[model samples]
Target: MSDQDPDIWSGIEDLWAWLDSHSPGDGQQSLLLRMLKLSEEVGEVAEAVIGAMNRNPRKGASHTWEDVESELCDVVITALVALRTLTPDTREVFVRHLARVRERSLGPGPGPRPA
Candidate 1:
């Protein structure tokens, strides 16, 4: 994997590139497929979190909150990569979708919120 800036955005791009190599952007694949992949990654995060919490008795467990955090970031980046892959116009779609979600959740807040 190519080294990029350590920001969340770059991490997302890295995951996207990895996904492109792995799956090659099949338009026939359902959104559910991507979502399932994202879910699997998140499940790994849950496992790590559980390990960090000492709920699981695994050998040589050095897991910490920071470890779980990076795993969570991995899950988020994987999900975003899937979204960006499925929707090429991701920025606009994300903006529009977030607007609709925010409206639904917050009862129509101020318009055009910053990223």
Candidate 2:
């Protein structure tokens, strides 16, 4: 996962700026709207997963696993953008949280054991 990619965050910031310019909402409202977008993106991921799995009888295998992967990327991008909306220092916040999660899950070692 290229979560550390500078270009990804740069693109997200550009998108956030464009969105803010177009929508022109207050801070709290903007944050709420951004947060809500996460759910929308998450739903798209679920749809893609179902399509890839051929779960829908009428539209069997309508989407590929690649499509599901793209949708999941969208969900991640949406989540990161929402986090940025809450604070300008989203990278730091994310890195800190990731560290905590790593410590908890990996016990401060080389990392979690492979399954």
Candidate 3:
């Protein structure tokens, strides 16, 4: 992990904290709302990708690749924020889930032995 990775999580947590403070709520509704926010961000990513690719004939390259990249970053930040909202130990939860996914897809690895 890069030195800046931790800082990114810290920033996301700070943003989430600030938002939560301004709009106080907890439990099921809060979780649902956060998850819904992730979907909205994902939709924006799709829109940006389409615009970047000039897929819409009417728009005609209305957005650049940089816009797509920014939207993708938003999706990631939104996902992490949702996860943090769902659990205080967001890093641990994410690490464990990612490890499981890696193991399941790539098998146990000690320097990439053949499957």
Which regions of candidate 3 deviate over 4 angstroms? 1-6, 24-26, 111-115
lDDT of 1: 0.74
Tell me how candidate 3 scores on lDDT. Answer: 0.86
The predicted structure with the larger TM-score, 1 or 3, is 3
Per-residue alpha-carbon lDDT of candidate 3 for residues 1-115, written as tens digits (9 for 90 to 100): 8765668768889988987887656667777888998899989888888888989898878888899899889898989888988889988999899999999999987876678
Clash count (model 2, backbone only): 0
Which pairs clash inside model 2? none
List the candidate numbers ranked by TM-score, top first: 2, 3, 1
Whole-model lDDT, model 2:
0.86
Residue 102 CA displacement from its true place in model 1, Å: 2.0
> What TM-score quantifies how close candidate 1 is to the native fold?
0.66
Cα-based TM-score, every candidate: 0.66, 0.84, 0.84
Candidate 2, residues 1-115, lDDT tens digits: the string is 5757568767878887888887777988888998888999988888888999999999898899999899988888888888888888888899899999988988887766899
In the predicted model 3, the residue pairs found to clash are none
What range of 10 consecutive residues in model 1 has the weakest lDDT sum?
1-10
lDDT of 1 by residue, 35-61 (tens): 888889888888887878878765345
